[model samples]
Target: MWLYSEIRTLGDIPRHYSRITPAAPALIGADGPVSWSQLDIRSNQIANVVAAADVVPGARVALLGKNSTRYFEILFGVNKIGVALLPLNWRLALPELVAILQDASPDLFFADREYADVAEKAIASSGLRCRVIGYDSTRPGRSALDELMSAASSDDQVVDVNPWHTAILMYTSGTTGKPKGVQLSHQSYLYLRLCEHLEPSFSYTSEDVMLTVMPLFHAMGVGLSLQALYNGAAVAVYSMPDPGKLLALIQHDRPTLLPLIPTVIQMMLDHPDAATADLSSVRVVVYAGSPIGLSPLKRALQAMTCDFIQFYGATETCAGVTFLRPDQHRRGIKLESCGSPLPLVELKVADSDGNEVPDGQVGEFLLRSPSLTTGYHNQPDFTAHAFRDGWYHTGDAGYRDADGFFYIVDRVKDMIITGGENVYSTEVEQALQQISGVQLCAAIGLPDAKWGERVVAVVVPEPNAVLVAEQLIAQCRELIAGYKVPKEIVFVSSLPITASGKVMKSVLRDEIIAQTSR
Candidate 1:
């Protein structure tokens, strides 16, 4: 067993685990299991190579890859030299990647073999002059990660690392506009681990085997993997999320914990293999990234014999601010709540004037925690606006009940103004989700000459199910106010979602506008 007092920096993790449980499995991937001692030595070698590359301290090292064990090695290795690790979203298009790379301007670019083409395009588009290294590739001109590791020494070296120093430069999803790089300090992550250690329900043990399908580029994946490593737990990583493959991994690995998004869980349950899959090893299942419908939640609870935990937060909050635990997953008002704040987190719903709002009144969610990001990198204006009055304005609109449970309404920017009345998109979407045929739906505001903006809904129906616009509107009208009802209903085969499972409302809104213009 390891004490929280032993962990001070990212460099301390491998050293502590290597000393205490040298033979324990620290990482288990498709290749094989890597023991703590091996991970420690390999990471040390990578760190030495990175430091000897003539790269200055506090420089950015960008990684473009899917989930892999090498990704973790590079992550911790960069941490040892006090350099920030910027995990680029490989799902992004060449143009988007170019824009982000230009903004980040990392000193080094590391790409997985599969993403070499995209990385090259991004580097070319941005005109960045940096060393390009390929992981698990024999491509000429580009250095190989394995060769670098083999040639470097495994002996650990001391580097000046400060808690307040930036450790990660995580770019936002950019659903609203250009992606902003969020600067997270080493202290922020350390504080997060402390919070997890203090909370028994969220804590991990060395005996636990955690199955992580979430993209390592996202905050949820990074935080979960780090927590498992810090606690000496073994991590089973899947490069990508596939329902059949995930079920197979669960049955084969017999992992104790699984963290996933609702969309992935829904797909897994819908798969034919789920019925017979041996999921008995799973004791806890953590889900977040978006609001899940009641039907799916209920079905998941009935099918899987495990604790269901709903985490609510954005990248800026380092994954979770509030947790909806299994015991609170009842069929009543609690179903609508995202649960209470986590330990060391302070939350309140504030009105436009920045004063705390009364219970049940919708307002912007504000939070204060040691785990919050330091600021947005290179965007002082945005950082100033987001971090104000000693609180991080989450930009998510929600309300607190008398019982202290927080219920999210919608994103402040996503709220619709119809006939001078405010309509929360989430309210309409929740009502739409209750309808039997609605598989997925996104509510947005379309520009209107009269109402300024009108409510519009794009829905995806369940397989073999047919939906009518009038019937859906009528169903929503019965549950919500008339103005909140979507004026326009467009049925599609699918909705645009980010890699992390969040609906890309900005993309949908643009498509609707284009159609209207046509």
Candidate 2:
């Protein structure tokens, strides 16, 4: 009974600084700032509620909410129990939410008031014996997290969870089939977050504020939020991606770190708010989740004086294993490299047979690190296939240069086969990004009666930007071989992306297939 090994979170309020500086304000909200001590008390109270819920060890608890105080409190509580925390994507459709709820089949579902209706319908349809709890719902049937916290004590409860045991279940953007739950362990997350905590040089400190518009369901959101909490930094969160409001928060809060998706950045640059926002206090602007378009990339560099750190990772990898440092993002290096493997992680390229491929050889990127996930939930076969040879096969085809820098060619599933020739979609997308009119693009394979599958370019042209299909094809023809050129181009307003900020190529492929069939 004495061997309680499961709980690994910083359960107790540690001995932190107090009088070193003035406690003017911390955790900013719409109303005002919440002090550090306040956050700690709420966290402690929530931890008690989680334990009082009778959530046994290894219970799966789904946190379905946006970025708010309640979400933060619930996460702390979940950590206390050492149970698997599944963060649901609020942006997804009701049906999609239901699918994940059913698939995870958690012991409890905690959602935000905004998603209460959807949660109820999804729960009823799936018959998920899940006890529903939310910030706003039935006073008794649906437990308000804050209320529960007030009724409980401020003591930390430890569970017998090993570091190797699964801690989080993050589902990837399921474009083709159902979403796959990636199981990250405490050991992996510890190494991942610990390695990313930046020891500040001069500017940023706990005094600085930050804003996070990125969805909390993804690994990026989790990493950023945890980093701030772990370091006792303050953050101003927004549930929606409103560029104007985000700018106001930036100017109002004088944030030090702003991590967001490229799409959101693009919106801000195009909006009227960009001209007046006082971003002088911003020190680091972290961007990832997808490829950055040249136009927005240039604007972002010009707009913010902060360093741009782009991370290449996924839900299964515990967020980051490779980092494209701000220095490596020069005009010459940006297009060619995704930088080298991080110091805390290991990376290698391997062939289909699991043998390590030679340097500079293009193959599946195999990653072995303490930060990589243990496996997929309830998917033994998928896990076995992915975690072979003591490494997680990233399913990405890329090569490492002589200097040990890694370059992602494209997803193996996204490789376009045209006339018996293989064309990496990233190569084509990179070329398309350089075109004068092309704003966003994705290269996917579409069914062709003559060639089985033809290279298809799905592009989002700039406003009033027009180009003949033939001219676009010629542009690709000049850069790549004739066979590699996109056989057709489909222009759309925007590209469909997953909640984690990854482009859903499966969705694009399906759209192209449907149109081709018609």
Candidate 3:
């Protein structure tokens, strides 16, 4: 009974849901399901707690915690008072955390007790005077969140807020340098739901229970969860990234919706219980974070027995600019395509001069969507360069087919130039994935004496599967061009993966370079 028209901002989502389905399960955390009414009251309690900490409108509050119902409560509660919530990636190092803390200069900080020591170190290192509240327990004298919320009133905090006000201060993955905070307004997150409602291209129903396993700090995890909530769907929050536990949850909860990265999907399939696990309850599997290879896609399609949707987007665009719908997943028909732009999403492939390139030509992806981020926080110069003429330069290299399907070649920086020929690392990785024993693979450009850059591949083999470097190369040759083939393949047990499920290619490249130099 929650109508999209009634909800103006992120705060209104819980309030609207509580009115119609007070007893409906809003969130299922480790502690169990929290009803819509309870979530609304808890969010009000959190808002009061945030206000009492002297945090006001336009200020920021940073949270360092894993996935939980409390995260949503804090997010909505902070939004209720017009304060943006910056959810820090708990996987970050102390100095990294300190850097973000110093950059944001938040009004207050919240951390789970698990990260107490690191949070204290970061606060001390950054010399931030902001008060710290622990989700589990604060410092000796100060009251923790539970104590404060228990004492605070559950009355709604009414603060007039602009829909354009920043609700999330999400930092980039920081592969290149310091992580830049991308400011996403309430409208940036909400508009996509409206688009979905109008189009229904991968619509969420009230009966759907979205099981989110990705880290809450990432865009995909929080974004998908909010999208589900906006549609009156229950969200099951699983904090850890354990594939075994994730599979067990699927069997037990029978969640209808799954938004998972391909890496996690691979791990789940490789798990011992995957064969026997009951995954029939799942109606849709949405894969994102990175491009999934054909091998894993086939395996998932066979195993899950449900519709598979692939989303392609970036932090700049809060929602997916393009989606490969279930019907488009047919074998040997545009399998590599990420599908056309979503409704209300205008997309084009542009050359370096910013002119739109003809279809079927590789170029940078330029997109403009209603849910697009306004800009990077405190980085006007960087923002000016990226967002130009009403289009966001995505730095992704790809081309659209004649039929309107989009194919992502590679990240512009990730493209390898070998012997004066362009080689897409994603293409090479995709080819390598076709090999029988290959489990996970990352292709990178390494410094070469002859070629400007040589293609080097780091591969992880399946368990108990035997593989040969020569044999894999021979197999890859059949799948792709000879020039695109990797010059060398290094076998490993696992590749470095980010918390968001992306392979840390820069880190992997550096490690490979260091090992080769030695």
231-340 per-residue lDDT for model 3 (tens digits): 88999987755778888899877899998876678878989989998899998998877656677688788887888888888777875778888877744467778888
User: Best to worst by lDDT, what's the order?
Assistant: 3, 1, 2
TM-score ranking from best candidate downward: 3, 1, 2
Candidate 2 accuracy as TM-score: 0.74
lDDT of each: 0.81, 0.69, 0.83
After best superposition, candidate 3 residue 219: deviation in angstroms?
0.3
**Please, what are the lDDT tens digits per residue for candidate 1 over residues 202-267?**
757899999987888888888877777778889987675578999999988889989887767888
Q: What total of clashing residue pairs does each candidate reach?
A: 0, 4, 0
Query: How do the residues 116-153 of candidate 2 rate in per-residue lDDT, one tens digit apiece?
Result: 78778778987788787777422322457656766788
Residue 156 CA error for candidate 3 (Å)?
0.5
Better by TM-score, candidate 3 or 2: 3
Off by over 4 Å in 3: 1-4, 137-143, 174-176, 330-332, 415-518
Sliding window of 10 residues with minimal summed lDDT for model 2: 12-21
Best by lDDT: 3
Deviation of model 1 at 196, angstroms: 2.3
